[model samples]
Target: MSGQLVRSLLIALATALVAVPLGYFVAPWLGWGVFCLGLGLQLLFHFRNFARLDRWSRHPVVDASLEGEGEWDGVFGRLYRHEKELRQQIAQREQEIAMLIAAGQALTDGVVLLDLEHHILFCNRTAEAQLGLKIEVDRGQSIVNLVRQPEFARYLSDNDFSRPLSLRPERYRERVYAIHVIPYAGSRRLMQIKDVTQEDRLDQTRRDFVANVSHELRTPLTVLAGFLETLQEIELDTEERQRYLQMMSDQAGRMQSIVQDLLTLSSIESAPPPEDEVVDMSRLLDKLRRDAEALSGGRHTVELEIDGKADLLGAEPELVSAFGNLVTNAIRYTPPGGRVRILWNRTPLGAEFAVEDTGPGIDAKHIPRLTERFYRVDRGRSRDSGGTGLGLAIVKHSLGRHQAQLDIRSEVGKGSRFAARFPLHRVIAQG
Candidate 1:
């Protein structure tokens, strides 16, 4: 027997001994009934205490009374410690959930959570702004009802969480976005939105550039091959041979110009941005104007105007190439005796450079794609003028690297103005 049971038996025996002696003495005076009643009550109390102890043994409580059992107490202690550790782990998990919620709110990308019924469960601040949604009103509302796009409705209705659907949310004008849907947990889902407009534009630009380069090269190669074959096959006088040689040289020069421009564009793009170096706009314009005049054979009048009080800070060679292309295009397209004017000025917004020409101006429809590689308003005119069709493309890239903006304003019959505006930070005080 255990110590508790032994103690209980001893207490019971002592009580019985005292009760028997008292009953023996009192039996004659008070009657046998009274003595028997007292003894029965005492026995009942002892049995009840024993029953309580048996119940406690089956369902043990870890308390002071349970200590000092040697082996048994060690097992009880381990059970108590394991329960405590489990509770602590649960508390840590709750804390992690709170932190994740805080982080999701701080993200710039739009995020939304939905339930199996296709109802909105939660939305982040970015989603509210980007999608024009209010979480308070939209929560528990059908996702299909809120997002009216037919494609998105179908995507949500489908149970597949492996692939996400892309969408351009109508809320943001002139922008595109990609969306991803993932099954969250136990009948829940997560949606993520990312901006991809700039990336898409860049992809299209690269494809067009590759095609243009191939076409430009092929034309020159074909001309050279055909001219060489004719020279080999036919016998001609000295004058005719000289003419053929001159034509070949012209074709070769055109090819050389295209290759050089390609190299310059590639070099500009591959290298890191140039360090800021102060450049005098007046001096650069004077040199460029004289060069343009010479290139035009003095057929077109070249005029220079400087109104800006600020100099420029960037790579001089890149500026030269960008500005020279604009001026050269003017000279090439303008009729003989027509005027080309280059203007430089500083506005409150930034420094502006404009090249205005009396050439046959571009139509309104072609203005958007004028800077595209090999995209010509008049291909025959461009070819006759010996244009590589990469000049405007070079200007566009150079301006982008300098964090500048290019604006073209033109009318069909009137002259055209091609202007570039640089940020105020890039403009320095004239010395």
Candidate 2:
């Protein structure tokens, strides 16, 4: 039995023992008075202990150590230990919750928690930045009313979280995000959001590339087919037949050039880094000048200046391709009688190969995307110049293999300058 129960029994027993003997020895009324007195004393002791326990329950900080019997002190000690354990458990849970919130805030993807009524219960920093949500201001507010996206509101109401919803951020037009909702604890929901703008742009670019290639091939193929039909169906004069056949051959050559450039680009993309070798840039530029002159056909002036560094360490063929592309691009773009200058020299950082032209220059806006594959600032003019629109792109990828960078400067009504910069590690200057 508990100490309190044993003490109560002893008090009752002692009271009865003293009261009964006194009742027999003296007057019965006097014995009854003793019994009442003992009973009152025992009841007072029990009430004081119970009142102390009640006060401690109401105000836990208050000391419950009773001044009375040993049993009451034991009761207060057990209660105090139990209360301490409960408080420690509560503190541990609070710490775990704080850690979870910190981790969620650090995530790149946005996270949002909702109540059964679709109210904003909690959200991370990413959600606030991505979705324009304010946690403190939007708390307890219905999510649909705050986000203001019709698609998202419909998604929430539909209760179908099998598929994710794609949305454009309110502040940015080019950016795209994917929002997904999942059912969670007790009718609450979790919304996860991811940024997929780059992926979306890449997919669109891929589609455009396929379409452009098809259109480019289809034009020449259609002309070749028509010429073949003409050659087979009718017998013409010798001179007339020669002219038609020559035109057909020219068309075939254009198609062949496009195919060759595509193949070159594919090779550059798939091949590993080139084996280290010395490149006699002086010799390479000399040959490139001849080729540019032959291509220009005396229509444009071509010049070369290799006064600085001449030799370098790199893959010879890739470097030749990169330099040749820049030279050819200058020749192709310059109008008749325009001047084209090719220069190779050493700078503080490394070596630079530049192609400057006197033809009509490109706009500042178009300069940034000049090296993108199949990108053209003037589609009609590029086609007329017999360009496949892959020259700059080829230069960029080939130079990348050599750890070089291409810088472009252009102003409309003036001319453009294209430069390839080789870092110090790759430049081996020959005296």
Candidate 3:
């Protein structure tokens, strides 16, 4: 603005000086008043043009009338238009940036932006919650200082933007996260954290389960096949033949039991959650106890205790299977004179069914993995008891489908307790 004012004042002063001298010398020969008037009008016109140019420069658009009027007018007009278009483009770009920021905020995965210097430039809401970040105070802070994980720091420093780093936050002890850093334009980077803990654990569990099941099945199958081959190759007496056949039959039956339990587990996992319906808890427990006692063949005494009045609302068959498996396991693991108890009781929030046995209890370290398929605390004892190693796995899946939880309490050399708790909402009065 000051520069334009200076140029205008210089032009006005120079024009006046030349005009005054020309008018004084030449006007007397012509008409003095006319020349003076013409010069005055010329000065007024130049002053008006300067004022118009100043006003137009401040505005986004200049008056088109200013064009072609003078050399300076044409130059100023074109410059004004060019600047106006550039401003409009900048406004459009800013809108796009705002939209992208909004989209990033709505994303499920946590997002963080960092500059070339590794300072946090921006973070979305998801990132704020997941990372426990105070964006206002943390902005411009170094990422290495804020995120103290050594693996994450190495991941960023290595510039391995393609692969994500796995991390377990202190807040979610059971979960795992995958963090990815992607290099963006202007030497900036985008860091994304995704929750993949469940998927990863499930994948690992499936792999281990398949391997365990194969091993468990192969052992019995190999034994049965070998025994049959020997029997076919040699001649045996009637008693020896009958004993060999009985052994082979037992091995084959063990394989059959394992396969059956596998199918039951698969069915439970694949099936949808059971619909709510009133079930007679007392009747169910009584029937299961009788069946367990019968299956025990006078070896172990089976007892039933029902203290719950609320009916269970779930798939009856699944519940029966789950409960029956617990009772049978207790009977099988117990000694010939041992006793098994099945109890159903009510609590404030729900109903619980517990199966307790007077058999050797499991170690504390092996309690958590007892529900895993083919995960046995004592492999030899489990196999000798004719366990398929998938009973608890089936129970786990079945209870899960019914929105129930299993609690196992055990101590070595003492007895163990296996209980299933069903939520109050899922329990109804018998109709």
Candidate 4:
């Protein structure tokens, strides 16, 4: 502005210098008239330039065609360059904001921003779903008012954020979330919400597993201890002493079986999937039939049916353990004179190894949890039948390694059928 004014003043001074010299030689007052006319013309030119600047300012867009004339050209050029730079900066900022939003959406956790008054500022899609909020509707609204959770309101009011808050919203009763609020940017706060349902479930499972192990071990250990103490302190007859020893050995064997099953389950869980060795279904079925008959000890009728020429593509030992568990479970559960049938069959999708028994069937509710470690339909009956309870759990893990699925269909008092179906990819045709 100052440069433009000085240049204008210099032009006016030169006009006055030329007018005074030319008009003084013509007349006395003519010099003043000439100077006045020249100054008026200069003012008119300045006014036109100002008018052009005003029109551009109303809708300022950087256009080369809008270049100014004479002294104003430098001013317009600078304005165009400055406007272009400003636009570039704005575009860059917009890109950064877009990337940040994308990253937030991709995250597993939810994010929310709030003002000092706890009014909602911004939130990601995850936050909306987790908190049951709609950003468009909830924005600028008080978070406590919208959430309406007394605990959340209290958490904010207390101003204590050293630990995260665990919440189980009524809307999502089964899910658990951990929310942490951090103060940032002077007065604003950022709330990070993470769904911890799986973590909480895993923690509970670990606790239950430990408790079950302790309980299972304690029963057998107590029996062994009692028997040992009686043998050491009392004078028993030969027959009585032999019976006590036999009972002790039976309890020892039960503990050993439990330990071995636990080890097998742990190995299956920790180790990678075994090599896909061709498992001979014929030989495997023959072995399973013999093991079932021996386990049944003629109490139940054991049968084997091979309906398919398809062998499994999996580690032989894993397949054996998986198939053997089902057969053993069937024989154990079947009553005396009941039938236990082991079958290798082909389905449209692939192949299946199934065990059917004429035992009392499982309840529908218990079917889903049947594969859980130490889960039993009847604890007393299972223990009496010498079941480790980890049999089904081990079977599940082994089948999973072979890319197979276990299906259980049962009805009360009608018996049960347990089938392990292998995907087509895991089935090998025997030539």
* TM-score top scorer: 4
- Rank the candidate models, highest lDDT first: 4, 2, 3, 1
Question: Cα-based RMSD of the predictions, in order?
Answer: 7.1, 3.3, 6.8, 1.7
Candidate 3 lands at a TM-score of 0.72
- Local accuracy of candidate 4 as per-residue lDDT tens digits, 1-431: 78878878898898789778877787757878878888898889888878988998899887877777777888888888998898899999999999988998888899999998999999999999988899999999999987778888899999899999999887888999999999999999999999999999999999999999999999999999999999999999999999999999999999999999999888889988789788888888999999999988889988888886888788898888888889988988889999999988887899989999999999999999999888888999999999988999999999998888999999999999999999998888887
Question: TM-score of each candidate?
Answer: 0.69, 0.86, 0.72, 0.96
Clashing pairs in 3: none
Give the alpha carbon lDDT tens digit for every residue of 124-225 in model 1.
898888778899999999878887888888877776657756677767657777788887677888888777779878988889888888887888788889
Tens-digit per-residue lDDT, 145-256, candidate 3? 8778788788888876776788987766687889988888969998898989789999999899889988998888898888889898999999999998999889888888
lDDT of each: 0.82, 0.87, 0.84, 0.90
Q: Name the regions of candidate 2 deviating beyond 4 angstroms.
A: 14-48, 61-69, 158-160, 271-280, 307-315, 401-403, 428-431
Query: In angstroms, how far off is 227's CA in candidate 2?
Result: 0.7
Worst 10 residues of 2 by lDDT: 61-70
RMSD of 3: 6.8
